[model samples]
Target: MEQYKRKIALTNARFYAYHGYYHEEQMLGNEFFLDIICFVSNPTLNTDDNLVKTINYEELYRIAKEEMAQPKKLLETVVDNILNSIKVNFHEVNEIEVSLRKSNPPFGGDAATAEVSLYWQSGT
Candidate 1:
């Protein structure tokens, strides 16, 4: 049997939001970069290209945007929320990968950006 797989991805989606552990970081806000990829199993090839048959990346962006707007103490929480929201709405997706990054993290000295990534699979 031949297996068909499709990947829908949104990369480097930037947002300025208040999500941090410290009060100062939350109050000041920071730039966040998000990357997400959705995997879909195509049991049968679609002769006709239908938007409904595939994941809508625009909708994914909206979900990420909405989730990022809500303040949280950790990037892990944000990543989990985004993953869960997608799973709930897009039941067709078999797997999901999300990475959230906070630029110019506090702690000084040409600091590196803080990042958290999550991978999810159906029924796991």
Candidate 2:
């Protein structure tokens, strides 16, 4: 039998946070959006409809929320922290992808948002 990977995702999680390089950006705060995807092995194992057999999305949300609550200077740091936290908490996860977006970034242009996407695989 061929083995396949399963993915669980949380999309468009919105938060207001104080995360940026500039002091004003921190004090004033901005809207941040997160989309997280987690990959696991043997998705069919959860066919029994047991929560324990699958990744709990609420748990992921809680972890992201907790991590986002603390301010950080760069989105890269925030992404790293989230990825590390998820990996530590869920050993079954094989890979994780995160997309973080900040609205109205300080650059002097009509940019709607600034975004970062990061991918992490276990044992790499």
Candidate 3:
């Protein structure tokens, strides 16, 4: 007997939205990058080339976009929302990893970006 696994990923998704704690930050808006990876238990479903067997990238993008559109003071909150949405909607996903980056953050120095990463697994 053998076990099979599959991973689907969406990387470098860019969005400009109002997500910050400062008043100026919200008003000014900023660019954000999102990366997501979903793990599946059945690898054969991927080989079958069936849409129903795999997570839809478009749907995943839409979920992320919708969540990002909402203004949240913390990037961690945004990541949590996205992660929960994916897990609820796509039960086939056994594990998920999310990375979010805010570019050119207003640190008033030479900071390029600020990022946060989150991982979630079912039943844990």
Candidate 4:
């Protein structure tokens, strides 16, 4: 199963979201970077010229957009939504890894950003 699986990376996919532990953050909103790696159980993607043989990137983007539109207090929640959305939408997807970074977090510190990452499989 591992050998036949393929990884598709979506890097620095940007979105504007109202997700934070603070009230100001929810009001002002912020820029978010999402990186996703989808493990598809299709070796044919390596050789098949047709995109139909692999997961569609457009559909993935739509899923991300919809998930981000809903506000959440924690990045973990967002990651969960993304993973579950993908798993539910695409049956061929066996596993997923999602990283969400909030640029310029509200924390009054020298840190540039705060981020959370989650890895999920279809089943235990």
lDDT, each prediction? 0.93, 0.91, 0.91, 0.87
Question: What lDDT score goes with residue 104 in model 4?
Answer: 92
- TM-score computed on alpha carbons, candidate 1: 0.93
Residue-level lDDT of model 2, residues 11-121, one tens digit each, is 999999999999999899999999999999866576678998888999999999998999999998888888889899989999999889999999875858999888988
Highest-lDDT candidate: 1
> Between the candidate structures 1 and 2, which one is better when assessed by lDDT?
1
**lDDT pick, better of 2 and 4:** 2
**Against the true structure, what is every candidate's RMSD?**
1.5, 1.4, 1.5, 2.2
| Candidate 1 lDDT, 1-124, residue by residue in tens | 7778888999999999999999998999999999999998863455698778788899999999999999999999999999999999999899999999999999894857999999998883
Cα lDDT tens digits, model 3, 5-123, are 78888999999999998988899999999999999885554566679877898999999999999999999999999999999999889999999999988987575989999998878
In model 1, what is the error at residue 51, expressed in angstroms? Answer: 0.9
With a 3 Å backbone cut-off (N, CA, C), the pairs that clash in candidate 2 are none
Worst 10 residues of 1 by lDDT: 42-51
Residue-wise C-alpha lDDT for candidate 4, range 21-118, written one tens digit per residue: 88898999999999889987645744658888888888888889999999999989999999888888888887899999999997776658898999
TM-score of each model, in listed order: 0.93, 0.93, 0.93, 0.88
